[model samples]
Every structure is written in C-alpha cells, then in structure tokens.
Target: MTATGDADLSVVAAALGDRGRARMVLAVTDGRALPASTLAGEAGVSAATASAHLRRLVDAGVLRAEQHGRFRYFRLAGPEVADLVEALGRVSPPQPVRSLKEGTRAHALRLARACYDHVAGRLGVALTDALLDAGHLVGGDGADSGRRDGDRLPGLDVVDYSLSADGRTVLTGLDVAVPDAAPVRCCVDWTEQRHHVAGPLGRALLTTMTDRGWVRPARRSRALTVTDEGRTALVDALGLVWPPPHGPDRVPGERTALSRA
Candidate 1:
C-alpha cells in the first residue's frame, strides 16, 4: 500500500478551499455534467474566473471536463469524488440563509435527498427504519448488540446491518440483486445527525425505487419527490405513512419518518 504521508491530500484541500470553486463542485455533485456557464453562475463568478477555477479542478483530478463542440461540461471524476463532497457536508456547518426561500430549500434538502448513490436525510433514515420494522433487515442496538451469540445491548447508536432471510426474498422478488460485498453499512447523515443506511444494499434499494418510478428528481434540485405509487407501495411494504396535513405550505402525503434522534 502507498504511504499516507505521500498522498496528495493537500491538492484536493486546496481545490476545495475556494468558495467559488466549492460552489461549482457542489452544483455538479448530483452525478450530472453541467456547462461551464451554469457552474459559473452557481459560483457567482464571471465566465473567465469560473473557467480558471474549473481548469484547476480538472488538473487536480477532482472533476472531468468533456468537450462538446463549443461548450464544455464538467462532472465529478468518479463516485469517490461525490463521496468526498457528501462527507464534507457532514463536517461543515450549515449555510446561513437570509430569506424564507433559502430556508425552505434547506428544509427540502433535509427532507429527502441523495448522498451520492444512496438515499439520505430523514427519508433515508425512514427507509432504513422501515426495513428493520418489517424484519426485512435486522440490525442495530438490538438484543445481543447484534452479535451471533445473542448479547443484548440497549441504546447503542448502531452496531451493524444485515439482511434477514425475508429481506433476501423481498429484494430478489423485486428483481434487485443483493450486493456480494459490503452489503450493509451505515452513513452518518449530515442533516439529521444520525446514521442512515449505505453501501451495496442501499444502492440497490435506491436503484429499484428509481426503476419502479417511485421517486423522481425534483426540478433543478437534489430533492426527490415521492410519487403517488411510491407512497402506496411504501405504506404497503413497510407500514410507513407520510403527510400529517398541516394546511397551506403542506404537500399532502409528504411524510418523512423520524425515529429516536
């Protein structure tokens, strides 16, 4: 293995150190390529300044730029890059907002959004909880601290996660293949400050949802809007119901599961 001391960590840190460049990176963290002009606007910079920043990122191997005639589109170099951005959010303080719109956007992000390839935020935590409640996935600070020896430990944050026999059946029934490696893992959600599921199983579940049309990307945003069919399917499969019916500004049936924080 290569020595950690020899790694180019500083290069990546430097690339992200700039506010303008960082905003540009966040704009494309959604696993999509965007034109330089779009990224420029995101950074609140001029075309020439954005070009310089993007070129630096490209050189750092943090982003990839593709040539399409007169326009160049940029995207994160790979999944690792996306993961880095997501992890950064976990450590960074929340952005300050001066208006209700900004606050609302932040709230929407906290409601449901993707952490790279897997679900995250309240929605992500809810899905994981549902899987446990349904006995499809078994894990947590359950009896026995999740040990095969059956030692019970209460109040533990999370020990681990594994698919039960029923989980395997249900997943296979949905035509989603269980991952062969690292099938179960936990990700600390930045917004909720709690653990949500990740790893192979999480990816498969998200993919199946997208394929089945249960969720769709929101316009110009990372938030995912659960469809009507999705709401029904979730209620059926996991007994998870959303929407508390508050009144105006309420999206009917828009439920996000919240557990013991």
Candidate 2:
C-alpha cells in the first residue's frame, strides 16, 4: 500500500493470490523471459491453464509478454514486481520439494542466486556481514537511516547500513562506479532470515563481479557460480578467511564459497 490508503494494492495482491501464478512469478524473478511452456512446467500447470494465468498476470501489470518468432515469452513487468516477489518469499513458508531435481535446484537457489538485479541467498547475506565486519558499511543495527522502518515484523530487529568512504575506495578499486547518492536499502532474505546488501552498493558489486568475470549467470536459472578468480578475489575483497579464528566451520576446499555466505 502507498502512504495513503488505496485500493490499487489490492490489484497486486489478488494477482499474487494464486499458487500457480506465484510459481510463475518466482520462475522469472531472475529477470529472464521464459516461453509459456517453460512457465507451465515451472508452475506444474497445463498449457491452457498457464495461458489463462499469464493473461491475468499481464493484465494486472505484474508481467509482460513478448512474441518472438513463433514463441511467446513472459517476464515480470518490472523490478518492482521482482521486489514484491522477494518480499513475499520473506513471509511465505518454503514450498515443498517433490523430487531430486527440484531439491537440487532449490538448494542451488538458496546458496547463491540473484535476487533481481542484486546478489542474494547465502552469498548475499555473508557479503553484507563481511562489509559490516570490515567497517566498509556504516550504521547497521537500525542506525543507518536514523528513522525506524514501519512495516517489518513486530519483534524482528531491523539493521540498516550505508556505504562508508573506505567502501567507495574499495568499489572504485574494483572498477565499479558507485552512484553519487546513497541508496541504502535492506532486503530480508527468505532462507537466511537475515539482511543482505540491496541498494546501490549491491547493484555495483554485482555488476563489477559480472564484468570482471568473477561470476557468471547459470544457464536457464538464477544461480550464479563464482569463477576460479572470484573465489580468491571475493575472499580478498571481503577479508574472509575460511574458518576464521572466531568464526564458523571452514568452507569446502571446492570453489563454491557460497557456504561461507
């Protein structure tokens, strides 16, 4: 809902009320357009049923469909829709896993997947923690904005964070262009139940990683696998030592440091 009471929110909520529709929304939360048949498979619905659902979503302004050659692909209408899906994930119960393939995909998503334009999952949360631990971000523990957030859970602690001067230097050194204005927003992670960097700094970090070939988008999915170079560079950037003297278990010797996140 907006600042003032408005019925427009109802339109969005109703569009999201259906389980199949919600599945389709999550399927494209990675910001990729998928053919209707693929969305039908993702949502486990018949083709005719999926078509009806897609039409409703498009009409509701939550999704957009484009025709390319003989195939019609659909994607979330905008980043705002992606944000709404992520927010819903924060509140909704985890969907049941019914097969080995689904289980593997779910696990991968929980490890290091993109949350719209920014990083998320275990990787996102850990990076946020490292930034705070390294003094590169300022005012965590509900102090960054100097104003309390109004819509979070009743007793949940809200930690807000901002980029520090040193953070600017670090990002510059990585060849990422930081926005002039501070865009500090905390996004709650569904699996971790913790906050990850989600504003401008988050966007720059993702872009820099992708541009430098430190990470690459997984085919047909939102999972991002860190390249060999990323494993070392990420550790250096975040000052993360596997199994730090006062920390948790060591990350696997494998290149997947997402467990550290």
Candidate 3:
C-alpha cells in the first residue's frame, strides 16, 4: 500500500481506537441514525465529550452526520464501515462481563443481533443453515463450486451464495419481497465464525421479519428478539429452530428436525 493509503487507514483506526468512540460506533452498527445525546449515554460519556468524539469520527470518514428536523444524527458511513466493525470484532478478544446487565447484553448480542442491515450472530447463522438445509439457498458452505454470473458482490469477496428457485418461492410465500435481481452474498459472522445471508436478499429477509412482528430490535442495542408469534411463524415457514442452537445453557448443534415443505 502507498504511504497515503497507510496514513488514511491509520486515521480511521485512531478514531475508533478510543473506548468511548468505539462504543458509539457499535451502538449504531445496526444502521440506526442516532443523535449526540443518545450516543453520549451509550458511550457513558458526557454530552460534550461525546460531541467531540462524534466530530472526530465524522472527520475521519468513519461516520456521517445528517440533519433531521432540529438535531443532527450520526450513522456509520455505509455498509463498508459495518464490515470493518465486524472484522475488528472477529479478531478482538471478548470483553469481560463486569455486571449482570453487561452479561445479559453480551449474551443477547451473541445470540441474535443485526450486523448492519442484515441478521447476524448465532441466530443469523442458524437461519442461514436452515435455508441451506431446506434447499432455499446454495453455496453457503464456503465452497465456490456453484459460482455463476452475478454471484459476487462488487468490492466484497462475499462467498458465491445464491438464492435457489425454490428459495424465491419460499420467500414470496413468507411475504418477503427481495429486490429484483438482487445478488445473494454471505457475511462472515464475527460471533459464530459462520456465514449468514447478506446483500440485498438478506436485507429483505430482516425487513420482512421486522415488518411482520417476527423480530424486534432492543432499545439502544442491535440485539433482536424473536416474538412468540415469530417463533411459530419462522418454524412453520423456514423450519428455523428457536432459542438458537447454541448459547448459554444450550448445546451446540442440538437441533430438531426441520419441517420442510
């Protein structure tokens, strides 16, 4: 890399190096546009301190600020920023859980959370697994054998996953309207170290779930909750196992039979 490129990379890294700034970044990783006050609370910093951190992040191109009526809101620059955050999480050691609340939040995030515009965490991985098992998607096993035209997303080396014809029909039945000719891509989940559906089709699935009241975002966090109705609907439609296959008090790979159509 050129010296200029190295300098640019270091600038962004420095912006995210502070604990308070990093907390603010993670708080908005779900693509929510939050104001300085909200971010101050999330970062556990005073309003003035948070403002300074936010300004630095914006100047570093790590975040973008927008005017919403009377206040300015901040969000990650784009999907690329989200990818960087997940990549960092992949290599960073886990933080110690110091309190009951912190432990709960950590557990919840690891179980089910949004990775930017799509689902992630263990639940996300399991959802992808169910889709693959049901023949709704192909190539999620990290193999490139099924590569076809338009399988790869530009600027991202996302695996060659694609939605199958049956997958289209299944999504339609579930009222999920994927964008026309949307490419399917796999996002490497930081927590699970497994791939989950991403790209345009992945966003559509998360949107449909939220719209149908199947999943709801927790306040101030990316963690998602699957409602009782969602549990039933997901199981009946996609055969996704509830409570995730692995987590606190759960066994790994202990999944029941899928109710395939």
Candidate 4:
C-alpha cells in the first residue's frame, strides 16, 4: 500500500479509535440514517464532538452522510463497514458488568433487541438456531447436519452462516425477498455475545420486515420492537413463538411498544 492507502487506513483507525465515535458508527449501521444529535446521545458525546468525529469518519469512507431538509444523517458506507465493526467486536475486551440494573438491561438487550443495525438478544440467538435447525444455514461447529444441540442461545460463538439451497427456498416461502447475492454474513453482538444475521442477506431480511410492517424502530432509541402483526407473521412465516409465559434469565430495559415507519 502506498502513502495514500496508509493515510486512508489511518483515518479509519483514528475515527474508530474513540469509543464514542465507534458507538456512533454502530448506532447507524443498522441502515437507519440518524442525525448528528441522535448519534451524539448514542455515542455519549457532545454534539460538537460527535459532529467532528462524524465528519472525520465520512471523510475516511467509513461512513456516509446525507443531507435531508434541515438535518444531516449518517450511516456506515456499506455492509463491509458493518463487517469490520463485527470483527472488532469479537476481539474487543468485555466491559465489566456495572450494576444489577445495568446487567439486567444488558441481558434484556441480548435477549431481544437490536445490535446496532441487526436483530440480537434472545430473539437473535433463537432465530440463528432456528435457521440451522431448518437447514437454512450450514458450516459451523462439529455438528454433522450443521444443527447444534439445545438452544445454543446467542453469543455462544461468533457464528458464520452461509445460505443453503434450502435456505433460499425457505426464505422465499417465508416471503422474504432477497437480492441476487447468494449467502449472507452474520455479526456477533457485543452485548448479547451472540451472532445475528448481518451482511447483505441480513440487510435484505431487515428491509423486508420493515417494509412489511413486521418490525419498527423504537422512539429515540436504537432498539427495535416487534409488533402484534409482526408476532403473527413470525409464527406464520418463520415459526417464531414469542411472549413466553416465563421470560429469560435476564431482561434488559423497559418494554416499549413496536412501531412502523
């Protein structure tokens, strides 16, 4: 690589070097373009500080900026950027569990919330397992049929999933419209410590769900909430049973209603 290439890498490194900036990147990676103010809160930084960092990330090609009316929204440039974030998360040291409240929240997030831009938590973990069990994904662990025993839950391993022939058929059967691309990538959640669907295929699935009003964003937050119709759709299409009489060992933040738009 030449000096220019080195400089480019340096820019990305610098932009990601800060915890605040990295959080900002993760916040918008899920395909939601957010304004600087929203990103600042997610990054836990001052508006001016976040804006400066965002500018640097955009210049480095780690993120893209779009101007809409009076607000400017930023997002990861592409799926590749999301991949890099996931890769880093795998090696990143775990932050100490602070308080019972914080721990509970973390558990909840892991059980059923969004990881940056993708589904995570228990839901994410279960979905990943369900895919494998259904012969939609392949090539992980020592399992011959690529099926793991029990509910491995999420965060057990940084799962790598490739779409199987049956996966395509199943996705279509579920009414998930995918692009021309073949297999999709998965990202390990930092909080849940489990793998969630990511990459192009993950993005496609999210898009389909959002388009169909199955899922929606929570107000002023990065988390996603499932809707009544979404619940029905999951059972009908993906065979996902929810609202178990008993919840998981840990539940995160307060439950918010699902929204569309």
TM-score of each: 0.78, 0.81, 0.87, 0.68
Per-residue lDDT of model 2, residues 144-200, tens digit only:
222446865421236545789998788788897777876467676666656677767
Question: Which portions of model 3 show Cα errors greater than 4 Å?
Answer: 1-7, 142-158, 247-261
1 or 3: which has the higher lDDT? 3
- Candidate 3, position 74, lDDT: 98
Please give, for residues 1-261, the per-residue lDDT of candidate 4 as tens digits: 645433356768888998888878867755678899989988888889988989889988988999999899897798678667766765788556889965765555445655545675556645555565556767552111225547663332435557888788888776677656665666555544445576556656666777788778765545667788877776556645354211232222222232222
Which stretch of 10 consecutive residues in model 4 shows the poorest summed lDDT? 244-253
Candidate 1 vs 2: which has more TM-score? 2
Q: Is candidate 2 or candidate 3 better by lDDT?
A: 3
Deviation in angstroms for 159 in model 1?
4.5
Can you rank all candidates by lDDT, best first?
Answer: 3, 2, 1, 4
TM match of model 2 to true structure:
0.81
How well does candidate 3 match the true structure in TM-score terms?
Answer: 0.87
Q: Write the per-residue lDDT of candidate 3 for residues 1-261, one digit (tens) a residue.
A: 645433458899899999999999999999999999999999999999998999999999999999999999999999999999988987799988999999999999988898889998878877887788787888645322324547563223555677888999989988898667746778667777666777888899999999999899998798999888888888888878765665232333345655323
Q: After superposition, how far is residue 241 of candidate 2 from its true place, in Å?
A: 5.8
Give the TM-score comparing model 4 with the true structure, all chains together. Answer: 0.68
- What lDDT would each prediction earn against the true structure? 0.71, 0.74, 0.82, 0.64
Q: Supply every candidate's count of residue pairs whose N, Cα or C atoms clash at under 3 angstroms.
A: 4, 0, 0, 8
